[model samples]
Target: MATPKSAVYAASKHAVLGFSNALRMELAPIGIHLTTVNLGPVNTNFFDNADPSGKYRQSVRRYMLDPHKVAQKNCKKPL
Candidate 1:
């Protein structure tokens, strides 16, 4: 899912995902649980700065997830 102009951003996200997966296993023995939610572009003000031109935002508008709904889903999950 790496895009042409987001090499660093993509790498950092991958790094975090790997680290979280490893940490989740390490902590499971102690009854700690970890959850990682991989989401696509979220509908938020972030695009105002990140995509100031609005091109990217417009392109992915239909694919964007509502922030409130995402939050509600995660919050409802049992921990």
Candidate 2:
């Protein structure tokens, strides 16, 4: 599932995850809480905007997450 086109995006997310973990540790001493929701690709217009050919959308349609469900569950409970 790795590709040259996604390397930058993946790397940036990795950086953010690492940064958030470090921040969480630092903030723990002050009783500040942090949460990270790592939801995979959600059903959105992202495909329509990014993939005009619809090939990518078709390929991942089965695995795509539902944005509403994701938001609802996250709002109802913390990780």
Candidate 3:
């Protein structure tokens, strides 16, 4: 159950994605490449102290992927 706070966090990540895309374009002429590993809901909090005791949170876990595995697999993509 991410509320208003998640908007800011999600926006920041989207901004980063745009920046990376532009950077890849700029460097492509020099043979540089980039890839964006867009992440979805994972088992972590946007804010460390965020409450995880709610039923919403509990249900979310049933579909949540492990952050470690996400990182490992995504890192192997061209970036």
Candidate 4:
């Protein structure tokens, strides 16, 4: 169980994504619009890199993603 201490943050995003995916499938007959942004790494600093040892720093940094690109692609209004 790879549980992160702050999983709710990831869960909220996943919930919205899951809802949209299912909703889109359900509403396809009616010509409604939807998109699910299944995203990967973006260049930003959300992870801690304070370790003096470069090994841990490098490993830890992989978890983060750039908010700018995520916002640009994912900021659907009327949520």
Compare the candidates by lDDT and give the number of the best one: 1
lDDT of each: 0.88, 0.80, 0.70, 0.61
How many backbone clashes are present in model 1?
A: 0
Candidate 2 overall lDDT versus native: 0.80
Error of 4 at 20 (Å): 0.4
Ranking by lDDT: 1, 2, 3, 4
Instruction: Identify the runs in model 4 with alpha carbons over 4 angstroms from their true place.
Output: 1-3, 49-57, 60-79
Q: Assess every candidate by TM-score.
A: 0.70, 0.67, 0.61, 0.48
lDDT score, candidate 3: 0.70
lDDT tens per residue, model 2, 34-61: 8887777788997787778888778888
lDDT of 1: 0.88
Spell out the clash pairs found in candidate 1: none
Ranking by TM-score: 1, 2, 3, 4
TM-score of 1: 0.70
TM-score of 3: 0.61
Cα TM-score of candidate 2 = 0.67
The CA lDDT at 71 in model 4 is 79
Give the per-residue lDDT of model 1 (tens digit) for 6-63: 7888899999999999999999999999999789999999889776888988998999
Candidate 3 lDDT over 1-79, as tens digits, reads: 3355377766888798889999999999999999887655677764245554455457566777787787777586643
Candidate 1 regions off by >4 Å? 24-34, 76-79
Clashing residue pairs, candidate 4?
Answer: none
Of 1 and 4, the candidate ranking higher by TM-score: 1
Model 3 deviation from native, Cα RMSD in Å:
5.1
